[model samples]
Target: MKFKFSIIFSFFLYITYGQINVKGKVVSKSNQPLEGAAVFFNSTTIATITDENGEYQLTVPEGKYKLVASYLGFKTVEREVDINENTSLDRLNFTLEEEDSLLNEVVIGAKKKTKSKKPKYEDFLVFKEAFLGRTNYAEKCKIDNQKALKYYFDPATNTFSVEAKEPIIIINRDLGYKITYNLEKFQIKDRIISYFGYSQYEELEGSKRKKKKWKKNRKKAYHGSLRHFLKTFITANTKEEGFDINIMHRVRNEKHPSDSELAFSKKIFEFQDKRSVPINFNKVIVKPESKLDSAILIHQRQLKHPKIIDKLIKRNVSYSDISYRVEGKVYLKFDGFLKVTYNNEPEEFNYKRDIKRRLGVQKSNFLLFDSPQEILPIGQIADQNNRLVEGYWSYELFANALPLNYKPPKE
Candidate 1:
């Protein structure tokens, strides 16, 4: 009887010790206080956004809780913790990995155009038009100024460039900006004449290409006639309006053994596709929490890096021409302003507030800044107002020409 009573008492003690307050300060990789970091456990609404000091306080009934910490432009962190009563995890800090804005860089042959086949220049121009046309998509109505930038495509090198006129990133959902352009935009420089060498894409039917790959994959081709139609659709019309965007996403949780976890333990994503349609992934989805609202998920991802490249191409901002070779990718020059929090003294410019002003001016028909030549001017304007406007002035050309037979191997 005595032994049983002792055992029961110990169990009660263990239960009592499990409850506690978990307190911590969330800082960025640079040791900067991460204000507004979302500290939550699992999918529960039991959550709190970090304070201006990058500090948070949470009460948990000890067990294993999936602790997620996130901020804009930063990677999302999911951690497991077992707490005890009266335990104060003071300085329990979270570090977020910075995101690489550049997507993929490839190189393709920059060959001359020939008459027997479609000139490489014509394909390049078609690609350019499809890329630029994406900017005009209706999604622009939902743009957020702070996260928005003008993307330029260089025709000669097939590089994508970026330029920012404003410094603030708006956090509203309908107003939040997207990361990549809906499609690629091509800029034309000097015309290059070349014959089509390979018929890589000639096999795909037009309708098949138009349909989402996932959808087509799920529903296999039924009739030979349908398959034939697909082939014709993709190849029949060289003059057909061409545009496509393909974005692949993977969401992993360590608890879920089937899916592999990411190395360095942060969210990693890459969006690259060679389709000829304007696919803005603006309404994109991220996994495990895909069911969760995007505003919340994307907002959490933003903590690491506040500056996200606008994938939407703006003809007014992009280079006048662009073309790609098979297996080639290019990086072009960009200039823009970055908004940083003031840990020391408040810089004269408040990026969050200034973004609105910049947007307002643009709406009022004010030319806020120019490109290449005006890049310096935009930064000067932001600096004059006491804000940070770092220029993205240079980039490398990964590939000037991409092969017609572009196929991304299965992951």
Candidate 2:
């Protein structure tokens, strides 16, 4: 699971107060000024370059952010900043150390020997789909550096993993943004995929008409999205934002036989049917040879009657139903699954066909892996790993991602 950094922006401060000025200096370990060092907040476009004096400044809204300073041939430095009414902005400074290039070279050399074999075409396809996702915008998104990716497959566990030697450059013509993604980790196992990365977006140059089209497309992508849902949910405006919330209870099927019972039954069937007799088995006592057979049988039964939502606990849920306040901080807590329905927009054709939902409404399922997730004022979950999502939200991946600083146009 990706670690989601939750940033709580002071919406009240943003609307009525002036921006905060953040000034900082970047110096080497030897106290030498580092010129042309890029200083910015991770995953946002709020950035500046250090001058000859290694001084950089930025005016930003009050919020919690991961500030980063990067220069070529030096290790990047990151600091967590909380800019509020009492923050002393001038204290924000960074001292970077030189990176060990020789160690890096040795590691790269060893990796090359072990992973010299080229990846199969089919493997690349799987990697692409899992990383880029299957949204409409993903169709127009292209990864510019395929060679930078290294692939490994473990047939024993049926796991596929990928790593990038450098930042992956992606050009999204539809959204009019060129993105640089620093992929940290990516893996696919047991039909579950997880990838963590930081992204920086640069606006693409285009004609006036083309720019207008991109703006419209970006807005379309933002609506009915997870971010939009979170913003509305925190503001207690789900209904106004065309969202309907419901509590769904998933129960295990009682009719499903236990693994031991299945194993006993399988032994009986094999003995009675005289199918594949064991080498040293007697008629009085028959035992399964390995766990693999039992696992396969259990999996087959689960497919027939998997754990399913048996009931709806409530409908038209309000924000208070799933949230609580402690010392002025908000946290979302709920039982079972959260069934979210977006009524304003109909389901896409691909989604409908693949998910096999005939209803035109857009519906998604939200499950809490870790309960009582903190909710920031900016509509971001403080801990991203705490929640698991399926359906519509799961379909929208990096292709539909927007910067944390993205703001919807005023209605």
Candidate 3:
């Protein structure tokens, strides 16, 4: 959780910008123009409504964006477009199909159980604060339509979940980006919140001054971010990147899981016919309550936060460092938690932005980001399961996100 912003904080002067025009229209599957449709580029604030003739125009910065066409009771259409200085005659047209239904809710009970009480207005607010994020900049984000979201809370498991049929349109005023999120799953349990979905972003239009401010804010937001760390990790520049990583091997306590984990371990053990075999839940299941729970526990305290633990039984296991393949895909090969810390002292570069708030305590072995391996080895990363508690990384949310096409400038 303790990470430096110095190395990753510099402004990305290499980012491109230019006012580009994108014209388009939304129509029905039968080719009839659909008026009043919501049309906008994903991840940007630049948006407009379709005119009576189903025509629309969006002026935005030059970059790759996902064009989204949506209308009430119609399936949203999304298209990717690259708008650059050389690009000409860029037209984004869409033919949307009517939605079968707007009611998109999931029921987990085997039988059709009675519905839970409707979520209160306050409940929705809490959900928004958690989902959109609690960062200071996250306050600028707004969900265009809240009614589009459906919430369900189960008392039996004390769990809360959400769903949406259409992609949730989120406009970030601070970042000047529009995000269209197709929420697949979201749930809150055990004081932890976890959700997964695909999303696309579009650049929103801003004045010269606002753009300058956004550029500065983005640099601060991007520093010490998951993406930034990953970029540095792949290149084996931890020290240069202001990160100190101390890896340790897994030492299973002679004791088994504590009372509850042990009980859950029994459930999995009995399911496996009492075999003393290592189970591969996501290849590394740290939480007994994890949806992918498949094995018994070796030590109840194995996943404790790295900052709180001292005198770790350092493992001498050898493995390749996190690096990239010939094709440039990052690959991770490790055995234990990479307890990382921000070695660089905080600089007075931006006194206002550096002021510490309730960013939560520094934790270790935390997964920086999701990779192809849906499940990570618990031994390799602390808090591999449960609600993945992010330290300062939580502050660096989607607002600071950049596309894969971005390549950092040479130092």
Top of the candidates by TM-score: 2
- TM-score of each prediction: 0.24, 0.79, 0.56
Provide the lowest-lDDT 10-residue window in model 2.
5-14
What lDDT tens digits, residue by residue, belong to model 2 across residues 1-411? 221221111111112135889998999999999999878776666778899999999988887877878776676677877787799899799999986654223233234213324456666677776777667888888999887777775555665677676678888888888887666667776777777665667788999999999888889888988778877756778788998999998786775767676777566656645766453222222343555354444545555675543578998898788987889677889998789998998877656545644858888877777888877665667666667777777777778777677777888
Alpha carbon lDDT of each predicted model: 0.32, 0.72, 0.55
Q: 309-348 in candidate 3: lDDT tens per residue?
A: 3334343222235433545334554444455555443422
By lDDT, the best candidate is 2
Over 143-209, each residue of candidate 1 has an lDDT whose tens digit, in order, gives: 2342344444444564333333322222111211122111121223233111111001012233544
On the 0 to 100 scale, the lDDT of residue 321 in model 2 is 87
Q: How accurate is candidate 3 locally (lDDT)?
A: 0.55
The predicted structure with the larger TM-score, 2 or 3, is 2
Candidates in descending lDDT order: 2, 3, 1
- The clash number for model 2 is 0
